[model samples]
Target: MKICLVGSSGGHLTHLHLLEPFWGNKERFWVTFDKEDAKNILANERKYNCYFPTNRNVKNLIKNTYLAFKILKSEKPDIIISSGAAVAVPFFFVGKLLKIKTVYIEVFDRIDKPTLTGKLVYAVTDLFIVQWEEMRKVYPKAINLGGIF
Candidate 1:
């Protein structure tokens, strides 16, 4: 299946990279907001740049929506898997609207409480996963899939 990986930079990117063993030469694309992470990932494969605004203002939300629109039209991915902050929010929302299967994996560090992205995306995601089973107490629908990376 054609899969799009979405996340913010740093730990999120690192987390997704762990799934490399499941990849072949070219079945996936990445969507992220970090310049350094983009540079590193693009050294081998192409990726989509989701906007990372300096201000968390309305303008930034608009930009993210536009970016999501373009990506949905261009990529037409069958599935979207995300380790999110905020940029992945629009993509996941658009993915659901487009009838694509959406999967959101909660961050490893967030065992005590759900992250904002996790809580918001839970309603739309086709699959919601948590590394720790403890998270299931809060979100019973979530799959305790262990860790992806």
Candidate 2:
């Protein structure tokens, strides 16, 4: 299956990277920031850099939404996955409209509340995964998969 792994830089990127076991053998690409960590981690992988400072940033959000349309239309990935900090919102929404499956793994640290990205994409996510059991209360449909860390 072709997978589009989308996330913000740093922790969110690390969270998705830890799932290499599942995506390693698949045809996959990434959508993330063009920061040092992302550049280093995905040096040899296919990656598309997205707009940043996405939290409460309307301009970046609009820019990313366009980027999402462009990338999703071209890549045509079968699935879109992320452990996010806002950047995944546009991708998930676009992917849903394009009939692509989406999986959002909530960050491992948030136990009591849902992250803004998680809450925004939950409705469109095909499979919502939570690292902590308590997060299930915040996201009733989330599947408790323990932790990816």
Candidate 3:
């Protein structure tokens, strides 16, 4: 299956990278920030840089939404996956409209509270995974997959 891996730089990126066991054999491309760490980690991988400072950045959100549409259309991945901060929002929403399956793994650190991106994508995510059982209380439909680390 073709996979579209999307996340921010740093820990979010590492979280997704840890899932290489699953994505490693699949045809995949990434959507993430064009940062030094991402550059180093994904040096040999196919990647598209997304607009960042995405926490509450409205302009970048709009830009990313457009980028999502463009990339999703062109790549047409079978699934979209993320361990996210904020960049996953536009891709999940647009992926929903395009009928692409989505999986959102709530960050390992947020034991009981939900990340803003998780809350936003929960309704549309096909599978919601949480590292901590406590997070299931916050995301009632989430499955506890234990920590990826």
Candidate 4:
């Protein structure tokens, strides 16, 4: 199945990378920020760079939404998965509208609190995965997948 992996740079990207074993052999491409770590790690992989300064930036959110819709339409991914920062929001939203199955992994660091992106995507994601049991309290329906790393 074709998969679209989406996430931001730094810790979010690192968390998603830990799932390489699952998607590496599959037909998958990535949507992430243009950062040194992402560049080095995904050097040989197929990827698309999303806008930076995400989160609260209204201008980039609109731009990223357009980019996400364009990518999702062309890629025609069967599933879209993400471990987010902010960039994943548009992808997940657009993917949902396209009837693409979405899986969201809550960031590993936020054990006690919910992330803004996490809260937003929770409603639309088909499967919500959390690393810590404590997170389940916040995302009651979330399945504790232990830890990606």
**Per-model lDDT:** 0.81, 0.93, 0.96, 0.92
Candidate 2 structure quality by residue, lDDT tens digits, 1-149: 99999999999999899999999999999999999999999999999999988999999999999999999999899999999978899999999999999999998889989888888999999999998899989999989999777
By TM-score, is 1 or 2 better? 2
Supply the global lDDT for candidate 1. Answer: 0.81
- Backbone clash count for every predicted candidate, in the order shown: 0, 0, 0, 0
Winner by lDDT between candidate 4 and candidate 1: 4
**Residue-wise C-alpha lDDT for candidate 1, range 1-149, written one tens digit per residue:** 88888877778787777777755554888878758866786568768777776235567668887888788879898888888878778888888888999988899888869988888799999999899989999789999988665
- Model 3, residue 125: C-alpha shift (Å): 0.6
Cα RMSD (angstroms) for every candidate in the order listed: 1.8, 0.7, 0.5, 0.8
Clashing pairs in model 2, backbone N/Cα/C closer than 3 A: none
Tell me how far the alpha carbon of residue 72 in candidate 4 is from the true structure, in angstroms, after superposition.
0.2
Tens digits of per-residue lDDT for model 4 on 6-102? 9988888888888989998999999998989999989999999999899799999999999999999999999999989789899999998999999
Which scores higher on TM-score, 1 or 4? 4
lDDT of 3 by residue, 1-149 (tens): 99999999999999999999999999999999999999999999999999999999999999999999999999999999999979999999999999999999999889999989999999999999999999989999999989999
* Per-residue lDDT of 61 in model 4: 95
Highest-TM-score candidate: 3
The segments of candidate 3 whose C-alpha lies over 4 angstroms from its true place after superposition are none
- lDDT accuracy of residue 101 in candidate 1: 95
